[model samples]
Target: MTQIATIIGGGVIGGGWAARFLLAGWDVRVFDPDPEAQRKIGEVLDNARAALPGLYDMPMPAEGALSFHDRLEDAVQGASWIQESVPERLDLKHRVYRDIQAVCDPAAVIGSSTSGFKPSQLQEGATRAEQIVVCHPFNPVYLLPLIEVVGTPANAQMVDGVADTLRGIGMFPLLVRKEIDAHIADRFLEAVWREALWLVKDDIATTEEIDEAIRMGFGLRWAQMGLFETFRIAGGEAGMRHFIDQFGPCLSWPWTRLMDVPEMTDALAQKIADQSDAQSGQHSIRELERHRDANLVGMLRTLKARDWGAGAVLKGHDKTLQAAGRIADTLSDIADPARPVLTVDRAVPLDWTDYNGHMNEARYLQAFGDATDRLMQIVGCTPEYIANGGSYFTAETHIRHLDEVRAGARIRIETQVLSGAGKTMHLFHTMYEGDRALATGEHMLIHVSLETRRASVPAPQVAEPLARLAKAHDSLPRPEGAGAAIGKR
Candidate 1:
């Protein structure tokens, strides 16, 4: 059964929440009085649809239904989760909560995308105080995984459920131990934001210069290792204590106006706006969003490859998605053994295309390689088996590029096991976009003993299943381009 999520506002943050929930297969109903709410949310969804699915190698769940409601009561009727993203005014939040609790399920989770207000504040005067919690997410909520979940001790179980729901949608829920103003990440961000404002006021750096200082320097380190871990490495052989002892004395220096707030006078505000306009005003906001999304996808893919930091979160989400039946799990899951096995089903990521405005030649091999890996896993050559000293090594490969493919295109690969006997496994893989053939790859692989680094016989566990697949595939018509050498066609 599809779950329902209600959005109380349809601005950037609210739309992001809607997109995240909808893409994760939850039916979303939105209530926003703004006449243009649907159009605005549609724009955000467009950006999300292009970017989010590319993060995974497997298929995302089919998007859920989205409906805009004029009445607040209608929107919250049967919703399991209600997210309030209204402007940051306590009285307004209290009013919204009163209206929500009147119609929403009493047991439903009411989450606030409040950056500063605590749950206790949001729950004040509400019919059900325990239902509300702070589920503050970063901008571009569909991409960035961090969500600060703040609730009082009385709301502990509700907070846990909120975290589990967030993880289901590929989000990292950092439960705030103590409900505080601005939660955890925002407090750190506020400090930096305050200092950045002062630097611009003092003429020390322009907006672009400040951004450059971050994206070009500590920001990269922060992306993968974060603050303390990065600093621990900076400590050299002694670790955190030694580095802090040496650099801690500099805390007393007058290098920053961290505690001081620069007055945002009209003149100062204009100056900053003018500088920012000069820095990045050439591109439209949507273009800038696309650029940021592409860069983020690339960086996140790197981390996912290494299984570090935010990348680890993405990796774990992929496993969760796979377990949810996005892909075939075992030989029995294949519906028709007479046909080739469906091995890969995913969208081409933005990074896979090049200056040619088409999928790069190398990415074809990468996709085919993934298909081969999937087939290996299906026939009992799983990660655990490989770890125990048995795996396939590609000895030779032939690829034929049949048609052009581009980023954001959904593609699939079907594999035919031509032969699987003794120490060798030969595979014929065909790539497709819908029903159109995009490419084909023929590969010859040898089962190897990882310990001796030499070709070796397969274990019975792997051999029997692979042999069965090969026998099943033998009755099917041979692939058209299976044996053709390069340039022969």
Candidate 2:
């Protein structure tokens, strides 16, 4: 059954929620009184469509239906998740919740995207207070995975359910133990914002200079290893204790005006605005958004490669998506064992392309390598099996690049088990863009014992399936370029 998510406000955050849900295969019903809500959300969706799918090596689920509704009741009619992203006004939020709970399914989760409001505060004077939880997500909800889920003990169960729902949509839900002002991440952000404002007001650094300081230095470390862990590394061989002993006293040195608030007088505001305009005003908002999305996609892809931090979340989401059978052209389904099995079906990520504006040659091997890994998993050489003692090690590879393909192009790889017996497994993978054959890779692999790091006979569980697939594919015609040499036609 298709899940439904109703978005109550179609501004930046609301549109991001809509895009995230829609891209994750949830039907989205948006209710915003703003006349240009549709156009605004449409633009956000356009950016989302171009960026999110590239983050994964597997295809995403088919996009769900998107509709606009004038009335809040109509939008919440059948939604399992209702996200309220209105302005941060407590009374206005209470009113929205009252209307939502009156018509929404009592069991349905009603999440508020309020950055500062506590769940307890939002729950006050509500029809069903337990149904409301604060699910504060970062900007560009489609890409960034962090979501601070805050709830009282009375609504603990609902908060758990919200976390599960968030995971289903490829988001990281950091459940806040106790309701507090601004939650966890925002408190840190507020501190930074406060200091940044003071810096600009005191002529210490311009906005651009401040941004440069972040992107050029600690921001990279923070992206992979967060604050505490990064600081622990800073301790060198001794760890966190040593580092804290050295730097902790500096906290009281009055280096920052964190407790002081710079009055946002018109003159100050204009000075900051003028500086910002000079720094990045040449590009339109849409262009800036596209640049942001592209840069995020590239950085996130790097994280995904290492399976660390936010990248681990993305990797787990890919597994969940694959397990749910939300893949392109039923790539996981082997309808006929007598032919090549469709293994990899995904879009070329922006980072996969080269300076020549085409998919890099090395990425071809990577895609084919993924296809080989898929085939191994299908034949029972899974992670658990490998972790126990055995796995395949590719001995040799030959790749033929038949055509040039660009980024964002959808590619599929079908693998044929050429020889699977004893300690050897040979595979031929053909990569395609629609019906056009773009590349072919032939790989010879040796089954090995992880302990000894040498060739070994396959376990019965793996051997049986391998034999079956090899026999099943034996009758198929040989692939055209299977055994061709490097310079041969």
Candidate 3:
């Protein structure tokens, strides 16, 4: 059975967790205190639903249903994974964890999305302290893969295992050895941040210039190779020790005040804001997020084409979701029930008829496949998307031999994405004669990574649309052919 995950809190982070799990085909139950959680999360999901599909080249599997709950205990019942994304208040976190302990299964792993707070502090006095772990993810958890896992010794393995599970879903889970107060990455950021504040305070450079220095210079290099490593390369052919010998003196240079703390004042904020505006002008928070997401997609896609490590991680996550079961099936079965009829206008060509005095069987299949392709394109599947090393390959197909149309029959194949997702998509096609549905075919297609020639998931770019089609056709019950199992290709 596909595991069910429960998310407590339905704000941005919680909504992202919901999207990640839902798109990957895990049933999700979300609980939030705000009365408007459902409406708000729905909007977030809608935006995600549109944006996520373009990330992949293949069809997406069916998305999991999102059930909203007003009660916390109701959401945790039978949940295999419980993610706590409540507001970052120690007492509030403790209270929520205590409540979760009452309903969640003993084996279930509990994760807190606290950026800098230690799990120990958050788990204080909680009944399930042993099961608690901090799962600090960068904003837009659905797109970014970095998830820092920190836990006490009692549930450390469980936390690591959870990290592995997250890795399976295309997340990069960094396991911290000991539960530190601010955690690892944040500590690194703090040092640079402190120095940056000094740079601004000393008027060494404007905020934009500082940002440009990082992004245009070291930041581009850092995407593929991190800090110390880049410095080693700068050290030349003599390698690390020699490089360090030559540049080690710079470490003593009073260039940055790494330990300095910035006082939060209106003047400081204004100075920062003004400098930020000077750098990139002003943009609303929403615009910034769009710009970030667009850049992320572009960079990740570029790296993905090259099969670089970071890109590979993203690709693996996408493909793993695709290779698994049910996701694909749910996505492909999207059909328009209200309008099952399709019309076609074409002249009767003599070559279409066979010796059997009917339209050739091959031609019928060909015509129907063409129609299916068009329908898929209309419903979000496109050739440019499919051809770019990701596409759907038919695994199994059954065409019901119905009443035949003669050589003069002007027909069009009506089709549906029957089901969608990484490896497999279920499609239903019908050959229509004017108003009558003459023949029907149920096809199971597996998305193959053309590079690997193995069943793989479609990249997010491709999966998102199939998900939409699935939602639209969700009310349309499963057809008879849907139950037929697809054989190995």
Question: Among these predicted structures, which one has the highest TM-score?
Answer: 1
**TM-score of the candidate numbered 1?**
0.96
- Worst 10-residue lDDT window for candidate 2 reads 324-333
When sorted by lDDT, best at the front, the candidate numbers are 1, 2, 3
lDDT of candidate 1 over 239-340, digit per residue (tens): 999999999999999988998899889998999999999999999988999999999999999999999999999999999988875467678888887789
Better of 1 and 2 by lDDT: 1
TM-score between model 3 and native: 0.65
**Candidate 3's residue-wise lDDT over 1-489, tens digit each?**
778899898888998888877876789999887899888778667555644544553434567878988787788889988999988788888888888998889878888888789988987897867888888887787777788999887676687688887986668898888988779888888888888887787788789888889888887787767778888898889888888898789889976677558786788778988888877677765567666665676676677777775777867765664454222222344344333323222323334567786777786676667655655555445677666787777777777757777643545565555566556677777777777867777777777888999988777766776666655666665665554544544
Q: Candidate 2 lDDT, tens digit per residue, 58-87?
A: 788889999999888889998899999999
Give all candidate RMSDs, comma-separated: 1.9, 3.3, 14.5
Cand. 3 Cα-lDDT: 0.72
Give the whole-model CA lDDT for all candidates, comma-separated: 0.92, 0.90, 0.72
Query: Which pairs of residues have clashing backbones in candidate 1?
Result: none
lDDT of 1 at 91: 96
**Candidate number that wins on TM-score, 1 or 2:** 1
Could you arrange the candidates by TM-score from highest to lowest?
1, 2, 3
Question: What lDDT does model 1 reach?
Answer: 0.92
